[model samples]
Target: MHSSKRKHIVVPLVLYCPLATFANTNPVAADDRLETVLVIGEQIKAALQAEQALTPGNVTVIDSADLYQRNIANLGDMLRYVPGIWTASGSTGDSTFFSSRGSNLDATNYDGNGIKLLQDGLPVTAADGNNHNRIMDPLGARYATIAQGANALTYGASTLGGAIDFTTPTARDTEPQIFLNDGSHGQLQGRVTTGLVAGAFDGLITIESKEWDGFRDHHQQERKGVYANAGWQFDDVVKTRFYFTYLDNDQELPGALTAEQFDENPYQAQPAAVIGHYQYNVETWRAANKTIFDINENSSLSVGFSYEDQTLYHPIVYSPFFSLLINTEQKNAGTSLRYNLHVNDHDLLAGINYGETTVDGGNYSHEAGRRKNMTTHVKNNADSLEIFLVDRWQIAPRWKLIYGVQAVSAGREVKNITVADGTLYNPGADYDSINPRAGVIYQFKSNNEAFANVSRLYEAPTNYELEDDSSPDNKALDAMHGSVIEIGARGKRPLGTHNKLHWEFSIYYAQLQDEILSIDNPTAPGTSLSTNVDDTIHAGIESLLGASFSLDANNNHRIEPLLSVTINEFSFDDDSHYGNNELPAAPGYALKGEILYRNSNGFFAGPTFDIIDERYADFSNTYTVDSYILLGLRTGFTHADWEVFGEVRNLTDKEYVSLFSVRDRAAPNAAILQAGEPRSVYVGMRLQF
Candidate 1:
């Protein structure tokens, strides 16, 4: 069952219609396309241009241009150049897992523990507080910003490690663009975007579709989506906009590999696994309305409301011998409101959000060509509120001081109903917490900045973690919390008359409480379950450096080089079970570097390299994965009304594990490992008018 309340209001368009036409709405000019084009290396610049002042923090922007240049097809591929972020490739697809400053990657089971993912400023994680399998739809994204530690206080909820915001294209200009790509493994993708502008009124529409045969056996995925945006500006004082998106996806589940299978062949897919019979399908609809009011020339206020509905289903095989069958369904809805205010040198922001999720399913076992069934249901609800303030004070003509604080309150409730032994067991629990953040930054010159801050964030145990009533009653195990401290600096310098260099570096430390840990409890003294442990700490350093140089007499021909790296140290503080051990899926170091050459004719070419140090599969550090490196190349050309590009990923054909096996004891039981994809290539063309 689903329930919600709403109040509808209609505004007369007669008064605003004529004004909309005279509002100087140049659709393409007002849009963020150009901003997206420079996002990858100029994220800080874009933020500054948007009036988002940064203190001594590490922030990175990944623009559409970077994505195109690198042929990034998924989150893993896109984040390879971002320091402090680690990605794992599984048979199913790509997953991102990371530790910032010294937080355990598994503290909350790697489902976006220390980081938050926002789609157009709305949370995309499910009610369970996990975003592991969620596809971000890179094809639909215009720009993304990653802010680390306390620097992310501007956004509410989960800011211990960082916050990531992915903004879609808005109606600002009038243009039409199309893109197509074909790659190995039967992979293909297509996208189209069009815009219209009439005075102060503008609109944009986009559609994208993709299909892939996958690198592993029995693995296939298909996805498609449409998005639309409309906007109206009432002079320089006020503006309003609407956005909507619809998506559908279907994929095959390939399951995890066994340890033996891993030792024999890390790239082999399990053909006879029960998981091979499973398929997952999902559908989502989202809409938002936003308003910007200019309180005056120096201050503005922003408010918005967003709603999203998502449905998912998975058909699974229950047993290997008997060939049992089961299917599960999940539905979710969420709403949020936010406001922004700027006055003098101070900025203030606040927001509130709420969401509801429900799961229903039935289990069936195949016996003598007959089906035996069981039914179940689960529900969860979440609510949150956040408030923050930031100030940029000019202490002197050449120095600036920045500071801010944020407070957040969050709560969740979960309910589960399962039929067993002719009786239905109904159990539920609720968890809640308050988090706080504060940070400061100092600017020494136009090209230099430094800062430090401390923040507290928490993760409510997922529905699955606490839904079982058989577990011992332990309040301390209900939630995970982390406290982080960080300091860093960034600056740019002219290396020559026609060359400029920029660099950013940061170091952080974190202390965690009631960290969740998964255990093998097959023969435990009580019911087999995953539970929480207490006291852990993680720390690390993250850095980025780059330079741009003119290659010819005309500044139009240039070369840009970039490098990024992250190193982490993770350990359990109170228990000996995992003392002084690296967290699972936590890579100790990663390096990414690239060089790009561009000419005046709108042509560009680049080569890239990605390297990762060894990592452990578990907290015990008993099993280790060796380091690996990958090479890639891409080139693009733009003519009067057309643009074309091609890219090759993993050109060296390196084999590595992007994701670890969560089902260590499951059937078809290869070693609980999932292999990485092989070498692949993609080519595409686009037209605009």
Candidate 2:
């Protein structure tokens, strides 16, 4: 007989209930009248949790409640606690340069590649796997989910870094709220949000504004955004939701500093940035719709569509004589169809995902950020199609077999409208790949489980990586292919009657062929080129451990300690040019942890620390970035309808390099290092009605 405990509800749809916010205000009467709705909402959450548990790889779910308690200025600040991830702020604070599983470690620009970003399970990253412009603001998300590596097969993501999905908050879980934040370096931010629920319709709207004069000279940034969504429930089995978003982001780029300048003053921008008036600005508009249909008790279908339009204005130093100004108009559209079914002892998921992006770009010669002449104009387009299927079959009482496959086709096309230099070359390509995955999950106890999997990954180069090369040895770029093997375990155990301990640990190894890598040209100091590497290996361990202990018999006071660690070993596998040499960029190890004391009356204080080891800065391993330690503290008070928090970071004011541009060979005077922020403090408060 099939085990009843193993029977799980599968729903690919995300719906918001109408009475959740109301119940928060009038608890007694609302609870009496809308008890069933609340239960159904909880059931939806449980179903999502079940889906995550069924996966044979590492997955992390972060709630907005936990995020709001900290200073969330950017994506790097928001996801700092997650394991197997590395992130640093780029030229501007709003842009995050991130890497996962040793992917995209050589990127020097603000637009990063190698990972998939999604909103409500739909693609937000361009079809070419490029994270262009500014990443979405995390302030409006209700929760976020991260599927590491090939574990994201269900989402049609076969990239090395896997996928991240952010779910927006609806009227169901939101109320009228206001927040204000202020910190060092003239930083200020504010947000206002409200929600409505009537009959079968519900909606939520939020507006946010933020600005900061950063720690370094010439580093200034501003942002304004609006997030709104409306849902209509036609019946218990049918629901449709519409979303709209608008964002305006503007920032001044502080060019990287040389070793001499950094030692003299890490808070000064390079002279080139001031001379060229470097800046990156963008405006964006997005809209999306999702509809769900419950065909039967054990089957459901979900359809989604999304569109985005963006305009970018960027200017930067190209040479001592002049600057380069880049202007681009970009558009993206995507659609998804997913179906979930349960039969006998198997749960199946099938989906199709399609997306396309077009960019009309122009390069202009400029002086002091003023456009003078158009040098180059081009139009680039990328489209992708993915078909995937996943199955979880119960083979024994305590064991389950998980298997999946994905078929992908992608095309990158470039049209040279005008080439001022008289060189006409078509550097476009089409790629196709079929990847398969298999795993086993064994549940040894009700609260403990272990899993192992082997999967394949493939990624097509982005348009940026396919740029025209004028070298004699240049050849057509090929797609990246790799095979990954992973093993992991997660569980919760009672530490004592009034406390609990929870832990998650995983290890992964990948053998890659034709992996895309970029390095600054040895002949040209400012320009970079991309090429495929013959052989490489990426291996890493990710772990998180946490526990809470009550300080009193009444459990009115508690102490909690949480730790996260990531160890990386990325190296070349006996290549022609670089034989068994370690890769540059990511550090060998990272450790972060916090110890907190909490009281039942909603007060908490914590001390946190982060330690990052040394890493190389050049492919030849000639230069090294020294390891550094950072200290911080957080104190906060929370209540049902209000909260206040304070934070201090880099207490010792240690000067160190946070990030750097990759190079084939680095000079001692090269201007490639980006300085880390110095000592700073921040405070914020929130109110809800």
Candidate 3:
């Protein structure tokens, strides 16, 4: 098999090391060891700060304190202000299509790649690097950490886009709260959370539900979920926590529209979507446990175990009479062990991660989402073992040396039983790699630092790319590799008694080999092909700048302005068919900015804008989508026990392409574009005690 290469631009990587010492790095005195109680929230924060300080690569942390005041309907709403990341709403369900470092630019919104998604420092993405967007809830997290490029090696993720980890709060940091929201298109949602503590035991639980009648026809969605956790502290040096989660999500697919169709009526569903009743339904259950122990005064160990089971039912149509139905059951289990040692201005971290995933399912010929006949039975399995070591040495008072390496062994196997097709192309593959990282950091003054790093990245093909029934020519795909270098600086300065300024900037370049790409078959309306490119180049600049100042001498009124920009230059490096051509789907530049006015009475209002440049839609650079700009407004009021917020999006009712399918070549009016949402309004409120 061979292939070619989203639009909303995304880019780059940088360094963000917190200025905190490792938790428990110093021994506790004997007199202070009696009648001690551990605060879970503070401990976790301190530990994470300490861990991130040793990372020599880019990292961004999003706190929940200001997020709740925004209209957070999906992941995009929460991550919009983060530099080097691009997120687009799917308009149906709670789905969000996101990209980092130009990863998975051509993949469909239903599936994601390159990025590793995690929950509470545990792996949520499958062993083969597949993740579902609808199953994630942004409101459930206390904070989120985005580690770009080689920074993710700490979590055993070796992908180009890196890793995102969402941390949940325990009972000690939780309060009884209720939330409700009502928005345009018949949207309604509700959530309730509570926590309890008894002596050394504490527990927290949350339940949420949502229903939406989408802006497009045949695009209704529904979701419900429960998240719960319990913790126990036996002593000052040992503690453990248990977690459980369940989610049920169902959504209707509106399918893509041709350029002409989009111009006529962007909200109309595709004819195939209506006739085939395209839909996706999923149910999942997950459980995990983490324990920490202080081995001695200068060392600590952390162990984690996780299990997940999921069921999926999806039906789609390729043509008038060619419909497909997929029913599958997937199970995944994983374990992780991390040890930390601090000695004489040196910090050493070593870890091992093992994961196994199994998928059993069958594909069937379908009519209007109903199974008519079985076509193929599938049994796919994947497993991975990763070992990593990192050491941060302070060579001088103002400088440090950081180095790390990760070794991985992975395998993928597919066994299928065919019914109608007379082809037996069951394939299995094994991959092994040792990626290394090196960097240096220099401290100029308090609250200011500069860093640089070079690292190797690798990613193996997922099972979905290998088990294609539409084409017998689909052979086993090879893993992609890349070498990258990045440099960055970050700091904050006090402007005055009531004002401050902060900024972060970085640039990165990656020379990639055998870059995997998936593109639509130009001859077919809905079919796509996958292949590897011989050579490619990805480079970008990422920046975040913000400031706040008092509007009056009394400091009763304040104004805040923030800006984030990404510049990308992704292209083919003298390829055979497309010589020095720009890659499709990712824009050349993107900018997001906002200005807010805040009063002493806890009221705030802001205007936000986003701009995305024009981009190509095919590898040959024959077709393109025009640039687009969006405007929005947000207003909110916050208090100690409750909050209220309102939002208006797409204020100009702009009609533009939100996403599209990739292709090797395309016609003038190809059926590849997905329309963006129209104007809408939302209001929400929360109460806590």
Candidate 4:
């Protein structure tokens, strides 16, 4: 699943369809669509929230408001406050890597594969389960749902880390605006968005351009993108929406600097990066649609399909004589069908999602920027078909039992056209897995609930991970499988007339077989090697607490304190060499907190802090990435249709590593670390009409 490209596609942000724009053009149509909006709003938000609460596993729904005006640059920063999700980024806004509850515990690179990413409940992650962060545009989304662990069975997401579905906004929530941000590191951002409605159709579109002179030398970057959606209603019972997007991205690679180099000149590029002009470039196009049909008062059917095409060009220094040059084209297509039924006290959902992705790739031997010769060429293809069923039964007014299952069949095949060594390729394999989940939710009181669940998950090896060139076996690697048991409680309630509290906490433990471990290729910088461990254990605790207080009349003055933490314990169950050793890159503790204040006159301010415990940098546990703390502040003013925000990151100007690479071994002088961004300031403004 890992390509070492460190980029995540941002397509999902454009895949959502919100047709409310059309109803706004005509008063009669507006009134006609109002009923549909009310019903669909539940389909888009409230119902999803209610469904999430019914899951015994940890699940969360985040509104776009959480990041809309916060100067979010990427998913890494976008998900900073989220629990159980940890990210390691190469630059302030570059590509990022993530791990949820130690799921890919030893992954040391930026490719996010273990976590399932969806666009409006359809696959954004490719057939092999690899997802790049390029498809997401934070400001263009309506909200997102995070289903942790087995709770993702409804989406047929069998990965240990679960799944995320990002929904887009409708005309009702749209505000046409122009925005810009100019800040430290010679960064500049400009964007324009518009929404409109006419008759039975609605449409919204956004265009953006950005450039950054990066914190490090020779790491300049530029990007241009367009996102748009149009939705139409044929009649009261049938409606369809279409999505389209285009993105162009080019980023210079400063590569990694050694610890000593980081302390000396963190802004300097790696030697190879400077000499070979290392970089990555991408061009993409995507189109998708979702249509809903009201089957009856108590049931509805939804169907969707999408297609995407991408071109990638990358050059990296893998060795002194032969840096790797990659030219590839990827095509992806998927379709989804889901039926929702609510009959009496029973709720059921049945769905089938299918996707296929093909890669036409070529590897080359290069000197500087020119390819000296072709190494190999191949067509690698993967496909996935999944059927899932979930049912929630109300046994009593306050108690409910939920059960779900997913049947998945997946295959990966590679046809090599050039002569290559055995270890350089794998014929690939096919896999079938059955995942089952059960949970119970008990409402102890208003706005409060206790829940528990047990589930099993399975994840197959990705195309890249099957690169065990040493074996001629069609299936070079085995699938990773696991079972998890979890219990938790969550709720929100008012303590007094002027104060309110919201809290949630959960603990989970899992036993796994053939757990995958990402091992660095010591001989080639940035290259990876993955293998399976016989047995492993993963456990974690996640919690969030927030309290709000109103201090004056009209409820204008308000104050709040927010706290979040995650504790992880992942280790080898038994191994002769590692011997019950904790997994590398798994932080023992990570915490975030904030104190915020707001005035009735549309003014607000907040100070936030993040702290991470020391983490092992390798399997041997001989080297480590030290703990670091970051302090930041955000202030904003919103009056009528005008919005202004200012953000200061690393208020202390503390120099640190926002993220680092884990490998077979590490040293002070090797290229294995990325310096955290220096203290920076960003000021932004948006005007809506």
Candidate 5:
């Protein structure tokens, strides 16, 4: 462990004192009022608070208030607004996947290649660092934050694309909340959350249940989950928390449809030979403790330890006649220690982390009768250290330079076992990389700033990619490396007397080396192999505009509006079978806009639109899917402690595909489209006390 404590002092001299006196002697501008200084100081304090929490890097925070306001139904829906994220659903609720940047959901075998999912700071992926889309549970999400790429090194897991942390409710207050809703497609949902706080003890619990008949034929789903959290504050230096979550879900998985099928009857079911069914059940328990020690006024040290246990059973229909059943049990335990030092103009953060993982599972390859059972066991051990230094320097009267560098060293090892044949394999791999990041912000007149940043990041290979068994001769694969350049500007301004506007515009370019690709060997059609490709490039622009206004006394109304757009271009640079084709599952553009209104009488109404451009289902781009737009409306009223709300989705009853299938090579040929949800209406009420 490295100590981050340091001391700083200014030399006292006549010349230096004279310069300081001259600087103070300068007259202040009229716009530089005391209140302005106070506001700026407050903002700086807030930023420092975030930095001190070891939450540096490129991070986005989505609070609970925003979740309720959006009425998000699932994990995919909840993350739709995030930049550089792509989500698709094959069935109503059972088949869903999420990808970040230009990566495909089904392509990467590593858990951290394009994205990593976490609950309460613990990884949710398998021990081999593979993420199973069918087992993602989102019913208990209270707050979430996302960190992109190598910036997420502190988590000590697969974080190639980035890392997402979902925070559940904590028991530190006395409150109770309930929500209910019913909508189109025979959808119904209910949720409850309650918490209690007494002296140094606090606890919270949540329960959620949802059911839907689904939009397409034979597409139905049932879901139920519960989460509980308890914490004890043992004085001001030590705190411990316990968390538990469980979920049971059963659903019908509707396969994709052909282009003709999509146009003719988007809600029609696939043939019996192609219909698929899936069921998933999971239970997880976690415990974490935090201890903070203040050595002095400007320096502090904190230590944390966490452990998690999870078990899952997933069965999916591979074809109409066959199904694959997978049973998994995983355990992860880790500890982290961090020290923070705050100086007059600089802050330093350093931490060390260690973890171990154990996985025991097997796959059943047949639908009925003495099915072939393949059991596997694997273990991973990791150790890492990271350090960061940031300086908030006042270059001039209105300019500040923010610069930082993060250095990390990590090593991981995997041990795998094959049950049937009693074969064993041990692959030990280790790598170290230095990620340097720098940015500058110039404060102009009014409340405006211009900022730009460039960073270098590296991604390691996942366990699956290292030991897929598909390639017997090639057991070693290189890691993925990339760099990103970003430029953006954001500002807040007041419009007239009753409104305010805030907006941001950014453009980024990313280049990846040693990009992983899974291809079918030319001589061996049935066996697919994984290897690193030459290169790939992704470029995109993202923009957001938001405004809020207040109305006159008679109406006593408030209105808030937001709009966002993203344009992306993803391509490969290689001479392979695919040839300069568009990356699969990468949408060209996405647009979303919404308006919300509230009146003094406790009435609210809002309308929203979500649109996605045409996209390809495969790298070859041989097949194309038509683009679609969806319309939704929501309204509600509240009286005292009771509230009622309703929402209608797909109001026009337009049919479209929610997901596309690129793997099936039958009649669909190039692509198979899954129908989107049809028009549905839901009404619900909630009481808070």
Candidate 6:
């Protein structure tokens, strides 16, 4: 039995692997190759190659093998080596907050801004751009892709942070397997995956269950889920896949504690939370399909459709005096189409994405731990449509030029179903915009390239922001618009050596108008609110470096070192209250590094470290979370048909705030913190047949 996180980091290992046949997520099955006649094959190549060659931007690809080495709890664990994204995690598996490009610096909710989430090449985010982060199962994913900024235009995403996609394994790549894991705080996980391939038909299914007693008091969760997919090949040129997903989760919330309370007892839940029995629970079901057709040798077309249903029950106590019981039923549908063409030295792609979501919900008042009366019943509908085109021309042998344009339309509508106290839903609002991009890349050296790009970004307000008619200060929230310019480089060392170094680095600057930020009302405790900032600046650097070293004469013993870090200097350009002060929440600088030594006989051990600089807790910067460092040790034995791993975290047992809620102008007494978990141990094992 064991004790106990790389994704989206561009490395030479992925680029040079010749056996990477299933890297692309689409309707095409891995074993759909046609051995009969000259079938119009080659329709299943990964889009990453085209996008990387044409777009002057950063791209990261993480394969399943990469995930086996780390903890598979949340997206935060999977995106550890990812450069641009920042993740702050909570006690439960799904209680994680992550964002890209410094978007919405103060809010820690699941509604992702500036970043789009996708599963198997289809949108997981609702039409209003809100994502249920729990829907993803990292353990079931075969690979993941990260597209940064405008480079994600091909995916119909034009946010400042970019897009990320999770791809599942198919029958061709799956074998009968079982996994078991046990960790600190009574955490247990069990999963099984099996698949079968028969002639032109293939099917795969996965089932998983998890239970955990969290590091913090009252933070407990139980989860059960299933993922299944079936594929058929009509011919060598046509293929399609149908998928289904189901999840049921029960989670207890441990409300945030005041800074003073956290200092005295990091593991204790707020008294009000315990008394009110705060909880967040949901049951979700989803179905999706993807099809691919090869028009000819030079072109291909892919289409995807999805439908999702979810029911949620949220009970929380914002303060000792205020509580809420919110129940919601939601329906969401989405469709996407993309066409790719390659002729001569030119690469072109055109795509459209459309999604609509409807919410039938109400918010009720609660007396202490019991529901009192219904306060507001409302229905909200949100929709988004986007069309985009990208063209890449290789004007010279060493240079490429990329140009792109996108058109978007978004709308939100609300209806007062049972208004007890006037109407709490805002009047409907609609938004439309057109954005353009240009970029250039040069192959300045062997296996190395330099890139630069400029793009315009637009983000629409989520339903929550546009429908906050009850809040006088939040009713008029505006859509956000910004411009970004970036330059970067990626490559590996010289070719004739056993030891190689791989690296990628980029720097970006963004100027934004109407940047959305959290605004707290001193009178309404625990109510989330947002307001637009007139001007803001976001500038940052993203980097990943890795090296392989030979330590023995036969190269049987080796060492691998990896370092990933992000440096941010985000601030309000000029505002009445914030002036040019740095933003709150995410640390200004965070670094993670690991060094592993391994023998060819399937034995490996490593030392890993995380360092985070001090950060302000609110816009007023009245207080700060002290800087912290964590040291960990991991070791494992990996062999054919069987593997096992163990790890220990927080060797120093340092006291630190893992996450916090942002406030408006506040004194030191107002900041609330979620303390980091104490030292822990984890162990896991897997069997394959």
Question: Residue 540 deviation, candidate 4, in Å?
Answer: 0.6
Candidate 4: which stretches are off by over 4 Å? 1-43, 416-424, 468-474
lDDT of 6: 0.77
Q: Which stretches of model 1 miss by more than 4 angstroms?
A: 1-52, 93-104, 107-113, 263-265, 272-276, 316-318, 321-335, 358-372, 390-403, 422-434, 468-470, 473-476, 519-529, 555-557, 638-641, 662-670
Whole-model lDDT for model 2 versus the true structure? Answer: 0.83
Q: How accurate is candidate 3 locally (lDDT)?
A: 0.79
In the range 310-337, model 5's lDDT, one tens digit per residue, is 7766554354434556566767776667
RMSD of each: 7.4, 7.9, 8.2, 4.8, 13.4, 6.6
The global C-alpha lDDT for each of the candidates, from Candidate 1 onward, is 0.62, 0.83, 0.79, 0.77, 0.60, 0.77
Error of 5 at 552 (Å): 3.3
Over 4 Å off, model 6: 1-50, 132-134, 318-320, 367-372, 416-418, 469-475, 494-496
Model 6, poorest ten-residue lDDT window?
A: 1-10
Provide TM-scores for the models: 0.84, 0.94, 0.92, 0.92, 0.81, 0.91
lDDT tens digits, residue span 390-475, model 6 = 88888899998889899999988766454565754455778899999999999977658899999998888777655543345324
Clashing pairs in 2: none
- Residue-level lDDT of model 2, residues 597-648, one tens digit each, is 9999999999999999999888788889899999999999998778999999
lDDT of 3 at 542: 85
Model 2 misplaced stretches (Cα beyond 4 Å): 1-45, 468-475, 522-526
Query: Candidate 3's error at 225, in angstroms?
Result: 0.4
